[model samples]
Target: MENDPQAQEEILEELVMALKAGGQSFILGILLTSILWGIATAQIWHYYRVYRDDSKSLKRFVFLLLLFNLAQFITIIYGAYYWLITCRLPGNYPKVLDVTK
Candidate 1:
């Protein structure tokens, strides 16, 4: 069957809208993940610098703390990706398009 030009145009518009929404959601997730990762890394680095020349026991504690922060950062990244995948699915047909033809 020959595809009607009007129907093709409507489908294209729907796809474009879905893609734009999904892209926006993905970008938001990336931004949030990056911020959290930066904060965690900075905190760990600060602690390490402060304890670099301290007693051996204190240095060990600082290392452990850094590891904990890294773990938390990983968890945050995983959650962000999960949310993006679930919320940004491209099947959301935009209501703005007039499909009543």
Candidate 2:
């Protein structure tokens, strides 16, 4: 079966479909995250501009929240890239659900 052209073609097509379906969700998530991040940035900017006399503690808290959001966004991008590009490489698939290792 290894040398059968038709079987190989079908297998290749299935693999392509699986990759497309999996990668599409990742792309959509990244896009949505980018939009939300932009909105958050704008809101934070407005907060600082409109409330210039806010307490230092409050400002620090808001800044920390923004940093955390940025971190989450960064991790999402890295995870998607790792799964879609790195794991999809030839021979990179994990064995029997041992993906975390």
Candidate 3:
């Protein structure tokens, strides 16, 4: 495909249109995950404060679980931002998807 600006613009517009439903689903999933992560964070804090005598092994397990959730949450937020903001720019998503095919 030649680097025709009009064709590129058309591709971008088409890509955005195709993404709408999937985008809505992504937003919904992000919202639900965010709420659950928040609640889990709060509960973990409470566990640390109130369960001072929890066996060391159990405390380690809780800490590990929290770490896992934190990592997942960060990735989800980053992915949402990357796809919705960065990739939505005029040139980005088309190249990423190799839309020429």
Candidate 4:
């Protein structure tokens, strides 16, 4: 059976409404992820500081891990902002999704 454009539009509208409905939850998720990332990075830094004189290689590894985690944190923050903007601004939704199709 062929898909009807009208049905597809209806489905899309419903999906958008659902996303809008969950806007608060999305914000909460973003907040929680950021808080958890901060806590993890803090713990890593604490360990690194405590064991700074343990080994040269271990220090380097911990430094690298911290850098990687920092990069990941930045990426996640950007993604969360993008998601929030996309979901909160319904006017751009069609244009954003249109590019995929």
Cα lDDT computed for each candidate against the true fold: 0.63, 0.80, 0.82, 0.69
Give the TM-score of each candidate.
0.45, 0.77, 0.79, 0.59
Q: Per-residue alpha-carbon lDDT of model 3 for 5-99, expressed as tens digits?
A: 89877776777775674578779989999999999999999999999998999999999999999999999989888777776776576664564
Off by over 4 Å in 2: 1-14, 93-101
Give me the overall lDDT of model 3: 0.82
What is the per-residue lDDT of model 4 for residues 1-101, given as tens digits with 9 covering 90 to 100?
12778866765776566566655675787788778878888888798778767788877887788788778778866776776675446465555455434
Stretches > 4 Å off in candidate 4: 1-18, 21-25, 86-91, 96-101
Give me the candidate number with maximum lDDT.
Answer: 3
Model 2 collision count:
0
Q: What's the alpha carbon RMSD for model 3?
A: 2.7
Q: Compute the lDDT of residue 54 as modeled in candidate 1.
A: 78
Q: List clashing residue pairs in candidate 1.
A: none
Per-residue lDDT tens digits of candidate 2, residues 1-101?
Answer: 25677865655565566667678899999999999999999999999999999999999999999999999999999999888777666454332124332
TM-score of 4: 0.59
lDDT of 2: 0.80
